[model samples]
Target: MIRFERVSVRYEGTERPTLSGVDLTVPEGELVLLVGPSGVGKSTLLGTVSGLVPHFTGGLLSGRVTVGGRDTRTHKPRELADLVGTVGQDPLAHFVTDTVEDELAYGMESLGLAPDVMRRRVEETLDLLGLAELRDRPIATLSGGQRQRVAIGSVLTPHPKVLVLDEPTSALDPAAAEEVLAVLQRLVHDLGTTVLMAEHRLERVVQYADQVVLLPAPGAPPVMGPPAEVMRVSPVRPPVAELGLLAGWDPLPLSVRDARRGAGGLRERLADASPPEAASVPEPAAPPEASAMPGAPAPVVAARPRTGRFARLLGRGAVARAAPVADPVTRVDGLGVRRGRVEALRRVTLTVAPGETVALMGRNGAGKSTLLGALVGMIEPTAGSVRVGGLAPARTDPRAMVRRVGLVPQEPRDLLYADTVAAECAAADRDAGAAEGTCRALVSELLPGVGDDTHPRDLSEGQRLALALALVLTGRPPLLLLDEPTRGLDYAAKARLVGVLRGLAAEGHAIVLATHDVELAAELAHRVVILADGEVVADGPTGRVVVSSPAFAPQTAKILAPQEWLTVSQVRGALEAGA
Candidate 1:
């Protein structure tokens, strides 16, 4: 139903084309996935199908693109709106209405559908996406994951023949992501709707795709095939696929179950090996160096605090947290928060010590981000106390708090304000009271390719995250908080972040990460804290906490059951040791 004939796109500023000779066809009633490294033009490629490329973005387009038998070059986005529905990376940018119900119906109303039809579709969507309970909530009030579902529901109500989604599940929790992917499955299987989506979290969505299109690198022609075939040559891959490659499986397994089914020999091979140890505090490093390539800047978007849905699924596995720490960097005791009538948090307590890493995990509205908000002084607790560096975070001075704690909120754009990457780095250095090149050095280490002149808005999801992290690290606060840190990062970018965080932990910094990325938790978090509906239901060591619940365990743990292995790196380490 979608065709690209020798298509290539180039934005005005860049030296290389965003897309080059991208010839491919997406069949009707099939779900096609776009996979690649960050800034490989996956988002730009999706824009062409909806005719938003040359028409709205002002990028030069050279190839013929057609959707539903209509030429996108001739038919502008507005003209093709009825035939195509798009949900970009940012959900807030997609909304045109205030409330969930209104947002869902807005698209249908634009198409001039009957009121009854719009209402019917709206109700169905709310139910399908588990948004029925939040129907009356304002778009401004929903979590990032919640807004993402609402955005998807809005486009879905229009019942377009094609759905072009960019990072559709990036903000969603595992359960919520599954629900969204299931909804897409139903749309493709039952309604004959076609879906073209690009997501960095392949572990969450790769198994569901009918076909995979890989953009190997920047400006490279895309490689297309069955999911497993493309994953073999693709640098971007899910943990299961990576595991399969390591095991020399004939066809790379796309799902955990597939790998698990063929793992008897592998399980025996790892029967006596132990998992790699988690990050430990390191000695202080020497002072910052002089020069390095510039890092990144990002768009402003704290307006949409990302929410996740896996909170409900979190209950599938639960354990109590570790013993309280003495002289903690931050502490929360029986904290409670209310957003209007919603009890966002209730009687929750968590503490992080110097040189420790803790992962705050739960589903959307599970109070993970809510707890982070309370710690960062963004949300005031109604019932309990929050102390950071011996000061009440909500009442502490902003300048004073900078030394106590720093937060890279779910929206990476929240901490960024400069026009260019270099400017952002310079500003970070000034605000943090650090050396001139402190922030830039860190940014370059985490993100190597971002140019100094690149605009924050022009950055890819991973690039923005790396930039935000660099900004926060510049402050050198005693405590650091990250909400969904890996939301937009690929495997390589994520590894770099892991290295950075591990180093920070080594440097006696306390880290609290609120995330839905199980693999990340497995790799970095020494402790896992699971919150469910505003309360801590599970807390313990990462290996113990994750293994207690089947749903929360990482891919390696699932495949190497009963052995308590949580990451492929652990298995790889063991194999290398034995070798």
Candidate 2:
């Protein structure tokens, strides 16, 4: 249904084209996944089909692009609205109305559909996306994941023949992501809708793709084929696919079930072997000796923190030891927070010790974000007490609060206001009283080689997130809180972040991350806390909590369960040791 013939696009002021000589075809009634590294024109390619390229984005387009035989060159986005429904990475920017129900219906109203038709479609979408309870909630009040579902439902209500989604499930919890993927499957199989989606979290969606389009690099021709064929040589791969490569399987298994069917031998080999040891918490460094100058009271110097295991192995020295593990960096007792008529958090009590990494997980609207907000002084508790670094967050001054805790919200854009990346980093360094290039250094470590002159708004979702995270880390707070921080990050980027966070943890920084990326939680978190309906339902070590819950388990854990393995690296390490 979508065809690109000799397509090449070059944005203004750029010497080379973003996409060069791309010839591709996506058949109707099929789901095609677009995969690539960050800023490799995945979004640009999707925009071409919806007639946003060259039309609204101010790019020069060459060659023909057609959707349902309608040349996008001739039809603007509004004209093709009935045929194409596009949902970008930022859902907040897509909404025209304030409430969930209104946002879902706005598209149909714009299409001038019959009121009855629009209403019926709205109800169907709400149920399909599990947004029924949130239908009446204001878009502003909804969580990031909830906003994503609403953005998707709003587009789905239009009943367009072609659907284009950018990181559709990035913000969703595992179960919620499955629901969205299932709905897309139904659309492709039962309704014959053409679905084109780009997601950094391939493990969540790779198994469902009917075909895969691999964009190797900028201006490079895209490779398209069956999922397995493309994944074999693709630079980016899912955990299961990586495992298949490691085990020398004839054909890589794209799903857990397939991997398990072929993993009996591998499982038996590992049955007696213990999983690799978790990253060790380093011992505290000794304090510096007092200054020896006569009459000068010894000037006390703080010791450095230790880095995480991965960082040490990689020789990055990203982490260091900061304080004794017994010291509590954050404490909450009988904490309760209410927003409007909703009790966002109820008597929630948790403690994060120095150098500990904790993950707060739950379905959409499950109070994770609200809890993070409270820790950062963004949300005041209605009852109970909360303290970070020996001070109440709500009562602490902004300057002091920043030193105690820093939060990277689900919407990274909220923390960014500068016109360019350079200015933003410079401002962050100044605000945090950090070294001149501290923020820029963090950004380079997180997202390397990005131009300083680039506007923050022009960056991909992942890039923006890295920038925001750098801004926060520049303050070097004792406690760090991240809300759905992995939304748009590819595996390589995630690995880099894992090292960075591990290093921070080693340095005696306590971290509480509210996330939906189970793989991330399995790899980085020491403990997992599950919340539902504003209450903590499950709290325990990462191994027990994630392995016991099928919805929260990582791919490797699912395949090698009964064995307590949570990552492909763990399995690989065991094999290498035995060999």
Candidate 3:
């Protein structure tokens, strides 16, 4: 269905070609996974299949790309629309219509389909993608995962034989992302549609892929083969696969279900082995530096407040009055929020205490993001109330609330406006009263190699994400809210972010993160709040919540391993300790 012959594509003004001397082919109805690190041309290759490479992105292209036997270079995006359906990393970027129904019908209308055909296809796509309930909803009012489903439905309405998705689930929470993946599986199994996708969170999608295409970094050659074969030789791998290597499991496991079965026999052998002394085990290593380049401006130093204003406000100021109590820093009661006519939150109640890390999780349309927004006062709760530091979010002054609550939004670029890394950090310091040198050091620690002069916007997606986190941390808000902070980050970047969150939690910041990354929740969050269909279905410690949820239980390495392991180091430590 698709072919690239010695294809080398180089964007203008860049010295290196994003993809060079690439040879790839996909047969009809095959689900191919494109895997690689950031800036490794994974998206660039997907563009070729969709006729967005040389046609829309504008670049010097050598060699030929054929889709359905027609030269992609000769066909415009519109011309190839009948054969190719492409969804980008950002779902909102592809939204051209305001309502979900219109968005789905827009593509069919452009193709000049008959009204009856368009109507039927739209209905089919909505049902297929589980968007029937949201068919008439406004696209803008939908959540990130909802919008992404709409994007897929919009493209699929054309009834293209080949569907191309670029990091389709990167922005979704784990449950929501799974829903999207489930739809892809349905497409392959039920409709026999060809799927070509690129994603960073391999743990989520790698298990279900039929084939894996490993793209070489800027200076290396690309590799492709069956999923098992590709994973064996690939330098980067998911945790289960790595564990499979260590345990010498034949045909390494990709998903937790696979790993659990593979480990069943190994568990007996492991149990027979003598447990090593705990004191002999080394402590977990510090997280990797955040900046891409060394000597980058350090992150700002956050000043710890001498007194807890909330404690004082709640009449716990006197030493004699200080008693053992739950660290409730923020409280919510009967919280209700709405987006247009849809109720995002209805009679929601929760509390976040200082020195606790809570992860908010749910399906795509479950209102996790909306609840977080209400906590930070970004959106007003229509019927109930949110309290931040003993003051109502609606009544508290904006500046004071900002100082007490810092949020890292789902879209990192929303917060970044500076020309360089240093400027961004400097602006954060001025606003938060953070120490400049400390901010620089933190930036260097969190994201190494990002220099003071590096443009924030020009950095890769991972770098941009780290930059956003650094900016939020500079303010040293007592309450930190992170929304899908690890969406597009690679393994190394994710480790750094996880470590930072762990450190922040240890330092007494009440951190609430709304994310789809279950591993991250296990690693960093002390508690997990599971939302389903706009309601809290489960609320408990991380281990209980993770191990109990059917959706999250599949990725439960942290619970099985003995040591408090978050990163590879922790796992290695446990192994070395014979745990």
Candidate 4:
């Protein structure tokens, strides 16, 4: 459906082309994944198909692009609306209407489709995207995942043959992301729609891709092939694929189930092929009584339950300790916050202890972010007060407040400025007036491969998240706050992050984050707080809160095997132990 010939594109920048001599073709009814490290022109290539490259984003185009046998150069975005549908990373940014139904019909109206045709298409889209229940809801009231799905439904209403999405699931929770992917899969299976998507978290979508298109760094050529073959040799890949590579397996697996099967086969083969060694006439090594547990079978190595390093790091010190402080670190009494003319938070009250890790979860605009803002004094409460570390967060001095609490925003790049990672760490330390290299070790632990000379922007999204966490840890505040820190990270990175957070909690640093990832909450958080319409609906221990709640319950395995296993390593440990 789409073809690019010597398509070299460069913006009016200092030096290099974003995409150089990219020669490729995407056949009809194919689901192609455009993947690479951040800022590598994946989005730029998606734009070419939807006619947004040379039209909306002004750039030098040295080659040709054809879609459905029609030259993309001759058709603008509006003109190509019937042939191609484009959804961006931020669904809210591209919204043209206020309500879900209106948004879905907006594109069809623009295309001048008849009323009967528009009505039929809108209904079909609403059902296909699973938005029928929320048909009349306001676009502002939808969750991040819901909003993205609605954005896609809006474009697909025009019956575009090709669908192009740029990081559509970047901001969604795992369950919601899965819903979107399932819908796209159906579109390909039922309607024969051609899909081209760009995303950083390949682990989530790699299993669904029919073909994979990998774009190397700038000035480098692109690579294309089957999903398994391409990911087997790709520079950046998920841990499962890397493990398969190390195991010398043919056609690496994309998901955990496949990996498990492959691993089982390898183990069986090893067991069958190896012969037992002959007994040697040598003195036996003495068994150490110190290594054995009283009345137990030496701790049963195979029975050692898988535990998330982050969860252990956070809960390690606090598991046996009792609470010492009388008042909680943060206390919200009848809190309410307003944004413009709307009330975001309403009569919300909650308290977090000194050594607690609370995960606040709710749909987008459900008031989770608003409540966090009020707690941190970013937004003033309209009718109530918020106390952090015994003092009102609103009345506390800026420096004093910062010393007691640290916040890591959703977009960490908004706060990052230094040229190097080490320099950024140093600058944060200097501002806090703390000891030198206070957070250096922590940063190195989270990002093992990162160096002092590495530029923050050059790193992957997962690396940026680690750097942000490190920057926040530099202050060594009593409380740490994070906003959807694992949005774009893969399974391995998420495991590392959970470990870091767990460690912080173990060190007696209270943390409260607003997020939509229920599994992440189940694994890392000691407590879970559910918000709806800006009020605290559910709050308690993480497993109980998420496993029982109507709005926040996670998967069956996660609930059943509750050591808070957030990564594959944790799951494997639990499985081997029969826990």
Number of the predicted model whose lDDT against the real structure is largest: 2
Candidate 4 residue-wise lDDT, 1-579, digit = tens: 899999988877426788898999999998899877645678778888888888988888778999998888888888888899999766777898999999999998998999999999999888877789889888886656678789988888998899999877776665567778998898898889999998776766888999999886754679999999888667667556655665666667777677665565444433323221111112223235312312112211111112477645444212111112234677676677876667787666565666678888876657776776677778778887788887888777777898988888766786789998889989888987878887677777777756687778655555677788888888878878888877656455677788877777777778898887665776677666766667655555565556455456543223223222233344344444443
Tens-place lDDT per residue, model 3, 160-252, is 899999878876766667778888898888878999998878888899999999975763568888887888887667777777777788888
Give all candidate RMSDs, comma-separated: 8.1, 9.5, 10.1, 11.2
Residue 231 in model 2: shift from native, Å?
A: 0.8
Q: How accurate is candidate 1 locally (lDDT)?
A: 0.85
Top TM-score prediction, candidate number = 1
Ranking by lDDT: 2, 1, 3, 4
Residues 472-522, model 2: lDDT tens digits: 999998899998888788888899999999999999899999999999999
Q: What is the RMSD, in Å, between candidate 1 and the native fold over all Cα?
A: 8.1
Error of 4 at 218 (Å): 3.2
Off by over 4 Å in 1: 280-320
Off by over 4 Å in 2: 281-325
Report the candidate with higher lDDT, 2 versus 4. Answer: 2
In candidate 3, what residue range of length 10 has the lowest lDDT sum?
Answer: 316-325
Per-residue error for 485 in candidate 3, Å, reads 1.3
Error of 1 at 146 (Å): 0.9
Tell me the spans in candidate 3 whose CA falls farther than 4 Å from its real position. Answer: 12-15, 173-176, 189-192, 269-327, 339-341, 419-423, 435-460, 557-572
Q: List clashing residue pairs in candidate 2.
A: 305-320, 305-321, 305-322, 306-320, 306-321, 307-319, 319-503, 320-506, 320-507, 322-507
TM-score per candidate: 0.92, 0.91, 0.84, 0.70
